[model samples]
Target: MIKYCIMILAFIVTGTTSAFAAETAVLQDAVTQTNINYVWTILAAILVFFMQAGFALLEAGFSRSKNAVNIIMKNFMDVGAGGLVFFAVGFALMFGTTAGGWIGTDGFFLTGIEGQDQTWTWAFFIFQAVFAATAATIVSGAVAERTKFTGYLVFSILITGVIYPVFGSWAWGGLFNGSGWLEGLGFIDFAGSTVVHSVGGWAALAGALVVGPRVGKYDDQGNPVHIPGHSLPFAALGVFILWFGWFGFNAGSTTVGDTSIALIAMNTFLAAGAGATFSMIVTWFQFGKPDAPMTINGVLAGLVGITAGCANLSPGFAIITGAIAGIIVVYASEWLETFVDDPVGAIAVHGVCGAWGTLAAGLFDTTAGLFGTQGFDPSIIGVQLLGIAAAFLWTFTVSYILFNIIKSTVGLRVNGELEAKGLDLHEHDNRAYPEFVGSDEFIEGEV
Candidate 1:
């Protein structure tokens, strides 16, 4: 009897210990998942933050010698100004509490948020802050030569504080809390095609229009002039950096740590490569020569096109989308230049390609991916069109009003003589390369 009792006691104790161990293991796993998500979110934010450098370099390279420093300064200032504005007001308007699915009204200054989950909040803000700066910087390139430094600073504040945040609220502010009519209608932007890209693109269009074409960009007959950017090598470097940073821009949109990230990164690269290749071939065939600038823009077009559907589509579909974007960019650039006179192909790469990316989401979304696989919804397409239209009208109208106001008050364009001498010497009172005067660096050697 004693032996039997001992045996039973031992069995009970062992079973209890095993159960306790299993429960502990499950709890540990949950904690680990939370920590992993925190780390990934921070990492992705850092990557997107670095894209500012890419933009700085790209814009600086494309600008005229007189405006190089001004271009770099504009890019830098936008980040600083936009960051402060977004933190103070933009974040609240974008991701705060929902009000009739229009805008947010809480989370101002990132206040009252606590715990590890708050890391996700910070990540979202920083990533979006960088994007807002990007949109503002696009206008910098468009209004490059003549825009006053002080005026550009004010515009940056407006973009991050009001313009970008208002639109962003509609699409991503959680106002829908993930179930609003627009979200329910399946307006799957995945990333900001209309929200970020088109916002910037349209603002750029407005700035270009208000500022007018660059001096000598058009002849007496109104035909477009071909003024090459000062530095091809610098432009190429900028393109590569942007391509590298895009891995984070698109893949990071998953907003979570998962195996899906790998797939998203792959799709990003595939689309960019396909875009570059197709643009190279198309330029060679159409223009009778392979154009470098078009090829770089092709890469950007592909990246933009893939961004809206990167998480929702197959790699094959991504490649197709990118190639089409590449071709579209070539024609769009030509057409817009003829009609609107964009200086840097911003309208083509960001504006036209952004629309294509948004529309592509409706057509190419597959149900087999991690985000889910529901192919081609007509309703989604309609919603996307609405989103696109809303973005264009809102951005254009706001920007037009802002520019006209600035034009009337402070004047948008500089004096004709100041422009003729280049804004660099007249506005900034400095030369990009004073030491390179009469040197090989200043002369065109061999192309």
Candidate 2:
């Protein structure tokens, strides 16, 4: 009897210990996940911040050697000056509490937020600050080579501190403490296809229009004159760097460490692959050669195009979105050549493709899109269009007015003498390649 009692007591003790161990494991997992999320967010923000280097190299490569230093300076200032503006007023305007959902009202200089999670707040701030800088830097390429440095700086401040933040509040305000009108309406921009890219692109369009083309971008017959950059290799390297960094750009938007990131990263790369393939084919058929510039730009178009739907669409649909964007960029560039002199095709890759991506998010959504059982919801499509139209109107109008203001006040374009001598030498008293600048291959006369 004593032996029987002893065996029964042992079984009960073993079962209770097992259950206690299981409960402890669950709590440990919860704590571990929280730490993982913090680490992931910081790492992702770093990746996005590194993209400034890619932009600098890409813009410098597309421009003449004489303007390389100027391009680098613009990108350098984009991170430095733009970051300060975002810290002071831009972050508040984008993420602060507001009644109308039009702008943020608090959180300026990242103060008074100590009541919330301090670690999370600063991580989020740095991530978004880099994004604001990115939107400002896009204009540099569009208005390169001829824009006055002071004028560009002024525009950059306005964009980061006011213009980009307003639009960002409308779309991504809910990401922090604010709520956006567009987000309330269910606009789907997973990683800023419309909020960042289109806003930047439209602003770029205005700046390009106001700054005008380079000195000899066209002839008396109004035909585009080819002005090749000094180094294609530099441009290619920049593209690769941007591609690598984009994994964080899309996946990191989740603001968490989870399994969903695998899908987002996969979708990002697939779209890029499709974009490059389709762009090469189109360019090959049109030019009897696969043009490197268009092909590289096609990669960016795909990245911009899939950004809106990256989290919503299947892998197959991601490819379709990117492939279509690739085609659109080729024709868009050709169309712009006749009127707009976009030095790097920023407007087409970001603005037009951003609209397309936003629409694609609605069309390819897992539940309500065309591939879904209901075969796409017209309501979603309408909302997407509305958001796109709203972005264009708001950004273009403000940017156009701002650019005009700069033009009238501090001068937007450099003078003819500075143009011929190259901006590096005259504006900055600097030269990227002093040995190779004697050949001003493209600067003939003002357009």
Candidate 3:
């Protein structure tokens, strides 16, 4: 009897210890995963923040030397002023309590999360703030060279604080703590092709239309003049930087430490490669010389086009989506040149490609695509179309009104004399190159 009791006690103790050990292991795994996710999110935000440098270099390289400093300043302000606006008003409107599924009603300035366990909230905020600045900055490139700094800053504040957040709420409000009508309708824009890129692109379109063309952009005969960037090498390097950062933009959207990120990163790589190759081929065939600018923009176009579908589509479909977007951006850039003076091709790359990407998300999704085992869902395509149209209408219409208000009140553009002399000298009280002076005639003749 004594031996049996001892054996029973030993068995119970061993079982209890084993169960406790298993539970402890699971708890440790959860904690480790959470830590990994937190780090990844913050790192991704840093990469996105670095994209501001890419924009600065790309815009400066494309601009005339006289306006180069102004370009750099505008890029910097997009992060500085724009980030503040997003923090104060944009975050609340985008991620707060839902107002009848249309907008956020409260939580401005990050009100609710105020303790030791909200580290992830801070990480998420920085990531989203950078994205808001990104959308606002696209307008700077579209309206570069002739825009009044004061007027541009005012528009930047409104875009990051009001226009972007309102539309973003409709598509991506549920990411943290709110619901949106579009997401409720089953809309899918994994990394914000429609929410971020398209919204920025359309606002850029409005700015280009409202701000008018550069002084020497069109001739007396109404024919457009060619004004090439001073340095293609700088622009190419900018593209390279943006490409490297995009891996974080897409794969990091998972916000989890797991194997799923591998496929998203692969899709991003293949899409960019295909986009560059096809764009180069098309330009070579059409222009007899490979159009370096179009090819350069093609890299961005592919990155924007795949953002919405990178998490959903197979790698092959991602390539197809990117190839088509590369073709679209080349034509779209040409089309905009006829009437609008967008110096950096921001409208085509972000707006048109963003729409294509959002649509591709629906078409390539396994549950809704013809390419998959299941038959395509028409409603999915319909929702995507609706979201695209809604984004354009909201961003363009609101942006047009906002730009005109600024134009009338504070002056949207620099005077003709200042524009001719270069904004760097007169507007900023400094010049990009103190020793070198540039004029339109000189730029035209390559003297």
Cα lDDT, all candidates: 0.78, 0.89, 0.87
Candidate 2 CA-lDDT value? 0.89
RMSD of each: 4.0, 3.0, 2.6
Clashing pairs in 3: none
**Candidate 2 residue-wise lDDT, 88-109, digit = tens:** 9999999988659899998999
Q: Give TM-scores for every candidate, taking all chains together and pairing residue i with residue i.
A: 0.92, 0.94, 0.97
List where candidate 1 sits over 4 angstroms from the true fold: 1-8, 112-116, 175-181, 368-376, 437-447
Clashes of each: 3, 0, 0
Index of the highest-lDDT prediction: 2
* Candidate 2 regions with alpha-carbon error over 4 angstroms: 1-24, 441-447
Tens-digit per-residue lDDT, 1-447, candidate 1? 999999999999999999999999999999888777667767776777787788777777776666677788787888988899999988778777757767776777888543325656776677778777777776777677767777677777888898888888778765322223355456777777778888888888887888777667888999998877778777788889888888878777776788999988998999999999999999999989999989988999999898888887788989998999999999988888875666568777887898898888767768622234544346666888888888899898998889878777767787655665665666577778766532212232221
lDDT (tens digit, per residue) of candidate 3 on 1-447: 999999999999999999999999999999999999988888888888888888888888877777888888888888999899888889989988889778887768877743324677788899899889889888888899899888888998899999999998998888877799999999989998999899999999998899899988999988889888767888889889889888888888887868999999999998888788888889999989998888999999999999999999998899998998899889888988898899999999999999999999999886667576688788999999999999999999999999999999998988787787777776687877777666552332232
Which pairs in model 1 have colliding backbones? 366-373, 367-373, 367-374
